[model samples]
Target: MSVLPLVFTSGWASGINAYAVVLLLGVFGATGLSDDVPEVLQRPDVLIAAAVLFLCEAVADKIPYVDSVWDSVHTVIRPIAGAVVAALLAGQSGSLPELAAGAVGGTTALMSHFVKAGTRMAVNTSPEPFSNIAVSTAEDLGVAAIIIFALFHPVAAAVIAGTLLALGLAAVVFLAQRIRRFWRRRAQRRAERRPTGPGVRHPVPTDGSEHF
Candidate 1:
């Protein structure tokens, strides 16, 4: 169950499958399944599941406030996965097509990261767990939708890929400011919590002259 979610979140042909499998094995060594096979090869169901999961993740990232945290976490993961998957898919296309795919893939990754990060940052202002959960779920759904549409209609996917990139960037600028504000407030609070130097320096008063 948990493995499925992890794989789905990782994305199709993203190389994450290989890394994730190995990581799982290193941690759960030979417990039930070997960790070398590609996710798609190992489980056809994973393809569909990935599509569904991505769709949800994507939608979740688009949510108003909670999208911020989701974005922060995905920042490192989405683009690389997008590029790898695009590279893999490009193999099936012509040179020109492949280049286009790669571009789309890389862009998709960048866009996804921005949108997720920005939205989450904005959401940080509220930091409501319920809102966060809702946004997270929506992004997962969005990822799935992207996968499905991209698989069925590459051209449409390309267009959407561009749109997503734009939107993600927009979100970055929008949420960055908000996140900064949140951080500033948090820092101020921390500073306030700190103890001021020595608690009331003892009056060296009478003994001051002798100490000197």
Candidate 2:
């Protein structure tokens, strides 16, 4: 069948939307492991696996506060997703490879989640309706793309998926620091810019006593 669904699923799993797939693939292929797993490149089973992961991810994202809460659970889903993907990719390759793949996939997913979660936190600080709309639209587009790509190209899809995860983690690290620095600088500047308190009227020099 089509591998597009596989690609889409992997992409979303890494916090990307289908509309942005081309850009993601370009960046991921250029800087990350865009071809480490070949099964997604040509296997139906692998493709389906990616689809399953994407589906599970979508469901996980919908439970109201569950999305952010999931982040706190940590140590739970990351390895599971990785293990599952690795196993799917491994096929007959054996358990060791499967375990390794799982580890990679899970970790990749976690990194993506971290970055996205951080972004959402930042967004929530902004005006209401707009933030909700933005987050909802983003999630919708992302889910749609994953479903589309996974059904088409499993292996290549997973490769791109992995790349997204890696890139997301990198982004979180890079941006978190930059944001912190920006705020600190802004605070410092604001403090400096603030006007000083009103000056007290001085008594005549000869008086000395009274208020100084």
- Model 1, position 183, has a per-residue lDDT of 72
Model 2: per-residue lDDT, tens digit, 1-212?
Answer: 32323422442464332223323333333444454234343355544454565555455554434444544454355445434543454543343455555555455555565677765444433434455455656765754455345434565656666666567667767677554653565478677887666784533667566564
Q: How well does model 1 score by local distance difference test?
A: 0.48
Reference-based TM-score of each model = 0.54, 0.46
Best by TM-score: 1
Give candidate 2 misplaced runs (Cα > 4 Å). Answer: 1-67, 92-96, 154-163, 174-212
